[model samples]
Target: MKQDGDAAVNVPPCFISNHEGFRGSIKNLIRDFVVTEIDVGGRRVTAASANHTSPCASSDANSQSSAQFKQESDASTDCDVDATPPSFDLSVILGQSVSEELEQFVLTLKDETTAKQELSLGCFPDKHHRANVHRVVRHRFPFLMTITIQPEIRVREDPDYRELSQLVTEDEAEDFFRFIDAKVRGSSYTFGPDDSKEHRTAVHHFMSRRFGKLVETKSFSDQGTTAITVRLREQGRPKKRSGEERKEEEVYTGFTLRKENLETLEAISYMAAALGVLPSDFTYAGIKDKRAVTYQSMVVKKVSAQRLEEKAAEFQKRGMHLSQIRSVGEPLRLGRLQGNHFDIVVRDLRRHGTSDTHFSAANAHTCLEELVKEAVENVEARGFVNYYGPQRFGSSQSVQSDHVGLALLKEDMVGAVRLFFTPEEGDDPHSHAKRHFLQTDNAKESLAMMPLSKAKERLMLRALNRYGTGPDGCAQAWLSLPHSMRVFYPHAYCSRVWNEAAAHRLTTLGHRARRGDLVWRQEGQNKLEDAGETSLPQIHVVTEEEEQQGAYKLGQVLLPMPGNTVKYPENSMGTWFQERLARDGLDKCRFRVSSLKLNLPGCYRPLLACPCNFRYRLQAAEDGRGEVMGGSSRSDRQLNGQTGEGKQGSLVLVLNFDLDSSCYATICLREIMKCDL
Candidate 1:
């Protein structure tokens, strides 16, 4: 499971050829990672792979790529010697004081008096088939005449060596770094992610968002408000057909809803329940935050304006109501709308300085505002890493859903079911109870004990009880859950793979294209086309200078989202992508289970995203109580306007911006806050 919420770990260091390299730290501050997916024509088209090519493979010759990769790795296994032998040494000493003359004569002994000894030493062999090359040393014997010599008793003070390079000459340090960098673009040690980067940022202690702060506005395709009345032009046909009055064949009731402290899925569930349809019946462009006020459009199908008007009170009772409801020809589907407009208020300003500096609480606020301005300018100029937000994974602070995805990839049905059903870090009472009892033989009794609100669990448990909760039963039970839920198992895995790959690409390659690195196509449909018939996606090969230019213009690169038909790049980043899957105990083959094919097809995400139309305003925070006063809620109708007419205090920063669909707002916030969200 992705425990990215707490981000309880640091960015693990990267290695090249088993040697340490320049390391970047991790960040975990932002909470409520929301995505405002910008609508593109369609993300359905994926990069095709060469015939029978495995994601675990690194080259184009099928296993030849993997084998070629093996050769490269095999070549890198050569170890350099830390200790080199110097020339020979000879010594003589006399024990008796009367023998001072003899000692002096012995001390003057010539090199001809010493005998030479030659020895050979060998290091551990690598690749098993290749023997270790031996080093030969020649040492001259010490010449002594009628003398007793006391060896010098010396103690060497040694400090612990933190890295391998510590044994090398200081002059070799740069060579090591350069060697790793040169081979890093393709070596697993350089780009392989041992641990994932935590993108979450911590919320400032003084800052907090007052929930139910959602404000909303709306627009419709027809530019009309409300669905109570409808008009039909009949599209060049007579108003009346076949002697009967022409009637509307379809209806799209579009309205804007801004619900405070409510999950978008739950709100849609409420609307779905009220309309006597499944939650899937209604579609939305993207999911919004559950903790704060988020405004988004909704288009319910086949519902009349009168019906919507009649249910207004019910919607309000459910902590949400529609406004600017209008009828159109089409129903809403995911990614139908443009993007979300976020009017977020981050409260309780506190100033923090870099490691070299500190800020007093009095000036902290002032310094914080200035920092945000500076960070905002930096963000506006460049772009933020388009990392997947926490929302992509479920919001349980403890155990995560990604583990289940990985389990599914490994085909561990028992493990997958256990992860899905068990009470996890963020599971509720019902979830806990269901998981606990369902594991027992009395699964039926446990089913009766579960609440109706635990519908998904209940359905799965019912299937398990009937089939007898063993492997077959669990498989049957898993099959009984919603297709979307089933698909999530793999999708979550895909998200992690993407997260790790992107992080590795950025850290190792940065923004510039390196030699052998694949760049996205600049023209045509702007989509990466298949490289050749039965080969991977078409990519551009750029010069080193172009790579540098690309880094300057972020987003010049593409980050492949992991999937069945998805082709990873052919550069060092591509090797890392394939290696990461292997490290995770997954491969492209695992993605194509006939039983779970709904989630098989994959897509591509940009390596970076700059928030467009970004802007922020700083203000003082209001007293906690005054934040949500006159807003209508499930309990009571408090205000007529969407947002209560009130001013935020002088202690908060109110930020407003329109983000591209699937772009993380938290990333932008992290760049500015320079701390946790």
Candidate 2:
């Protein structure tokens, strides 16, 4: 049990502030205000928005990127966007949003293509938490640029290349020669689908959407697969050459990856270990799916494209193919992508049938397509709910729960250590074994299981195994873990609270607040800017009715993140969220613990999600490619309820949508699936 003293000390010094000086609001951007696919607007991607530019090997590459940004800024146009819902009975979708006016539920719906077959559905998913460290940033002053030899793993590639190429869409695949003509300097040498006529032979089979488990399509064999074929800039070691004019070339390398089941983190870990470099040496912008066959770029310092190619066979054995090898002068950074072009295949529509039912084989294709089309159009009109993805919370993993981070924030050293060291059965044996031995006081035995792979956890365990239990030991162990990993837990807790707060606001207020309700001011169109500053005045309540300021805009609704400096909305829904925090044994005022590196000052996120460039297409699986495994598994049987109404080798629905880097694609899909909120 947590002690009283711990709670008292945990209250941040700022909690004492009356917050009476100014009744101004803390402004924030809606979390779901993502740069949609339409936002890309056929503009060439560029390095202008990159976090940092390194002195590299190429001048033309640098010049081209800068030039493209200027040229493309005006040329940028949104993709095909539906400003309003279509005339065809949008009552089902709108009713799904509010839930009251529902004369048209899924029960009444029947597939038009397959003799009016019923439609089955599935839902959204994620592994993300962008930390909000504004509380600490506030105390530091106007601006403090402390550049460390920091090694944060995330890729940032030049966008111009992905944009300039016609490969951005399925339609662009037609003109290979035109694609080559407009390609950048090194792109001609890179391995692409258009490289050989054979590459295009079975392009449909290799399409990203068809590759998922839902549809068991034989991936047409190809010399070069589309495993994130892109030229990325690598920051390399500049060795002094005894030449007349010594210079630097921006060493560009093609960072390609294709793996199933293994996540990006583990892949980077394996690659780093194999190369004898620190795991931090590998960086990429986005973390791909662990279960899905996803591809993305990665950066390795000093590792030449040639060296990576030579070891490609060895790398392949590690379960992931890397090809399309080349080098560039600019290194990829995290949070630096226009958007992901998704080709997701949703299978098992026929399983929604009342029984092992009957429908025409040819009709199966048209039926699935229309149902999928309805889902796609619905998502396009009303965006998905921007809930925090499932990955943020702990499951059966070593970092058992984010509560440990909350404990640390509360200054409950004992509680933090207990949760951190507690070993649960059926968990990661590596973490479990070490923690078990440490708690058992078998320091020597624990060391055996504690390897470099377990560095973060071992640091804490090592301290306890040697020094035994105490506040000093616990504190030291907590601090020893990498800053990034340590921050994730507390940040995750904050996200959970934020998600609840968002949900409450949307459900209660019809996605907007009434006059006199506490609402946040807009800091910017797409960012929560001010709460990060240490100093913030007491928040002002919203006097203007939401409808007065165009109730439908993304800017109108921003929910506060629980923290000390941030004030709760003076309304019933806001009180509900505060009660939720208390129920979780958390206090908004305890966010600022002076000694810790991060503190959640609390900011606002959008209450709703409104995605654009939302598109989907339903298609019949080619030949024996698409198969429904719904009846085989117990879970699938439960999901189907009634099964096999259509043909054995049934149809599949393909969903195509673009989301912002911070947004969850799963949430968007969840909205379409109409699963429980």
Candidate 3:
């Protein structure tokens, strides 16, 4: 027999045929009871239906809800359990129930008195403890229907690491994947995914966007390379060295350059050689392209500023020029580039021949339009997914995002259950029950906090710390779960091997980019600390020089009264600025200014108008994944009247770029512009 509300119990080999006589003594075990007699070899076996009862109390609201749902839905939730009843007849073996004659003989050999005593001992164990034996059997057999469920982990698409250099040809791209697959040995690499769904979503986001700017980019026939110079972010002041430390080491001035997707490195190397120093003596942050313009910082110790200047002159003789040289403060590392800025000049005048002047300006106009549109769209769409980028994991490894996701879901499910448990009574009953039975808060506190917002943040931090590797691996877990959970309590089980696995894979193989690729942003003026201690660099907008030149003319139109007659509208920063300019008589003025600045996050900087024009600064900020924060500001809002907006009336070119401490923004920008550099 089975316990109440549980499944049927299995029959032990020692059951007696006459045990049914005592069935009346068992409470709740008599409902629709059925028994079957079977003959095994020469012995008799009985199969009896285990007793079951409806749940006595629905303390768990979720469980109650499930029950109610089934009651109303007319579904077959119980079909699997009730399909087979325990009442079939199986006493006969091939139509032969232990021969009557044999049965009689066996009965005679074993006296009824002795047989009854043995049967009683086998069924009841100790005569005085029949209830205990029954309870033991019920607990051990657990007459419930057995269920087998195999969980499946989700699969995520690998992150795309394709760069200008990586896209040599279709075949080369295939080969690169193959190389990566081989390196991973089919170990299943994930792109720092917290869950499969999130990973897939991120992949789709990347698929929808373009990599770099459009106007200045060019195509390559073969697997081409570009040189990019990654200047180490300058340290405002040098670290003080102790006398003992200073004397312990030789002050080596320069380092060597290695090959990669850069042209600038080659030029720099050539220049170094001409200056009577071996290429090995010139240490660079990273190698740049030979065909494209790449800029970086180089260090030379023991050389005076005059000698450095002389070397610069010698480099110019060999088609290379060193613009400026500061103290070689630190050793340059690889894969560092501030964001890249491009000024491409495309010729061949597809529309008009070299001699014809009036053939057409159509092609130039079309090209310009296409270039601007592509740049805006690509940047807006594929800006950032915020997960650990490919660089965090090596080019060869992929992460299993599903594991991270499941851990997150498990957390969520527990939280949901807890929410349902919250009753107006302050849950004193549930608390007592929980303490007495479960003695864990996993299904309560830990899981209760798994909403998308909270969970996503935790997942992101987990990914960042794991793959980004600013701090130690174990320490990253604290960023996710509550600190109290770390004590000898419920949180102990939260940090399972699986959870740690997701984090483990994150830190070691974080670098996802192959080679010569980057994420670009503008360099802003102020230090990041000024932007409310923001995590990302600050990117403030600056007026292009071209615009600044026309400021005096523009000011003349807007400031007719000059004496602050009308203050700019409090809510109409953009409109007031525009109306002020319109009042000036320079309506037909045509000038374009191209401005460049570091696109950091959380910082706002104003753009200066020409000598007299009003200044408007850009406010661009990005999150952990190089994603721009804040929406389109007034400056970014293109003017769209009957004619159009952002139609440049002035033109000026500025050359500059900014990179993070560990990234090469120039390479990233080059890939976007499709330029040689």
Candidate 4:
């Protein structure tokens, strides 16, 4: 009953069920495992259900015009509307004679075709009058950007100058430039002289929003005043259909992402490439299993449904599909899901018996059904030990993720870097580059040999080549990976600790609420999303009185993942956590890697997890045809490579269940199968 890979991570062999488990293989076909995410609203996200039109889609022509009209009215009320000369109320702010002359000037400027046309409103003696003129020009004649020189208001009709007087601080400008560098190509912005950097930065941001990366910007001093210029980059503008425009109103687009045999990130990368956006632009509630066909909700910023629809064929060719594409108010954040519904098929089942004799298909099916029922009943009654699955520790026996994490925690950058570059067994594409680096200690050469698909490795190698393999270089190399990828090592280590601690708690204290144990202060508030990487959930330590009163059940108790800020239990479990960390050459203080900005502020997780809506079906595989249970349609089954054919003379077990967020279905399967997963 020992767990595979437990030696590396100290995960113990344990099972809550005493019912005998039969031999079976899972994920024989990609379709054998189907997962659909359950959103926060407790609605399961499925492919079939996602085909309906989204309510947030853009309205028809008439409704769009009405919306536009309403927006314009709102703008007018806010004093932000672009008013024409006829509609402008210049007389309200200026004398009639002056207003008439200003209106005439505005008309002249509007008609001028020159790249830059300027007119000076003879010095307004009063500063208040000058301010009013500036405001009037901004709201009334938005095309004519104005700058005040002393008491005189000078108006200019420069296409780039329009709406360029808004403010953006230096810090904001720097941050925007960084974003542009990271996410854009051939894009830049410039600001106009208001003698204010903030105003110029604001203008730059506006230009960026309007033109995106299609244009670049530059600023220069003109007569002691700074002015910005935005021009098309060398790449030039993309050819667009007539009347086709970007939907500026669409900030975030929510869509159902269905992928087969691709990890969530990998699928997102493909979608992002097809849509011509960065992979980081996509956000999902959780990462789904790679080997399974999964359907989940995903959101991308500034991407329209039309754009996504345009890539439909490409996505289909890649075993992916998108549906229910619509505008959403916000992007999806990780761990926002309530849970996931699993439709898993365990094929090639063989009942465990006193003798190794093959049973008839009928007897085998009946026996397996009874066994499955008992297992399911035991699980529903006693629950299962919530251990982090083997996937969390990684598939490599040569080196686990927690090993790199442990090195990182000890601040052994060189060791961590070496571990990262360690060559794995089998035909790994990165092995040659890794071996080259290890042998020659040449990051540049190693990078040249590295495959382009190994993006994280290439990034680290580049950092190392540029900075040299010193402490700082190593740190930079590790940090060069995407935030999600970089943090996984540390998080994996935390998972290892949690798994070992949970096992120890189960073996020593049993599965019962005890004094000094920690439970979530509020039910359903245990936002230990993404394994406590984002934020800490509120928890309350169990008092002796509460323990004796049987106030908290075994499922209510939680254990803390080691971190700098988390409080440990007052019982022996807490002491065991400290002792375990000590054995691993770590302490709570070491969890904070200040230089790397990797702080582990730990969170709590329930030691036990029960499957909800649990149900199972056993079918005979004598004819190599097995039926799938749950919500899977025939089309879905076919798309996932389920051909209704499995091993002959074998029984198939189809399990349908819903697990809470952060719970691993693999662990649940292992508990039922009583075998290494």
* Per-model TM against the reference: 0.56, 0.54, 0.23, 0.64
lDDT of 4 at 486: 65
Ranking according to lDDT, highest score first: 4, 1, 2, 3
User: Judged by lDDT, which candidate is best?
Assistant: 4
Worst 10 residues of 1 by lDDT: 145-154
Error of 2 at 32 (Å): 25
Model 3 Cα shift for residue 162 (angstroms): 48
TM-score of 4: 0.64
10 residues in a row with least lDDT, candidate 3: 16-25
Over 249-351, each residue of candidate 4 has an lDDT whose tens digit, in order, gives 3357888888888877667766766687766678889888888888899988767778877887788888898888775556788788767878777766665
Mind giving the per-residue lDDT tens digits that candidate 1 earns over 1-677?
Answer: 12112342221122111111111122211222222222222111111221211111122223222211111102111111112222212111111342343334434432335522211111111111111011101111112101101000111111111122233333332333333222222222111111211211111110112111111111122343221111122221223336664354345566666565567766766676677655555666667766654556666766766787788778887666566565544555654533443444454444442232322234434455456666666766666666776666766544477887788777777777777766654456776565667467566777777775455667677887899767778778777764555676677768767777776876777655565555554432233322111113345555567665654244556666777666667678778877788787775454765654455767766666665445454433224442412212221111112322143232334455555566666555555554434
Q: Best TM-score goes to which candidate?
A: 4
Q: For residues 233-324, what per-residue lDDT tens digits would candidate 3 score against the true structure?
A: 12212223462433212233432222122244345445544555533344544333333333344554444446666675555554444544
Question: How close to the true structure is residue 629 of candidate 1, measured as C-alpha lDDT?
Answer: 21
Clashes of each: 37, 30, 78, 2
Instruction: State the local distance difference test value for candidate 4.
Output: 0.66
What TM-score would you give candidate 3 relative to the actual structure? Answer: 0.23
Give residue 670's lDDT in candidate 2 (0 to 100): 53
- Of the candidates numbered 2 and 4, which has the greater lDDT value? 4
Query: Which of candidates 1 and 2 reaches a greater lDDT?
Result: 1
What are the lDDT scores of the predictions, listed in order? 0.46, 0.44, 0.25, 0.66
lDDT, candidate 3, equals: 0.25
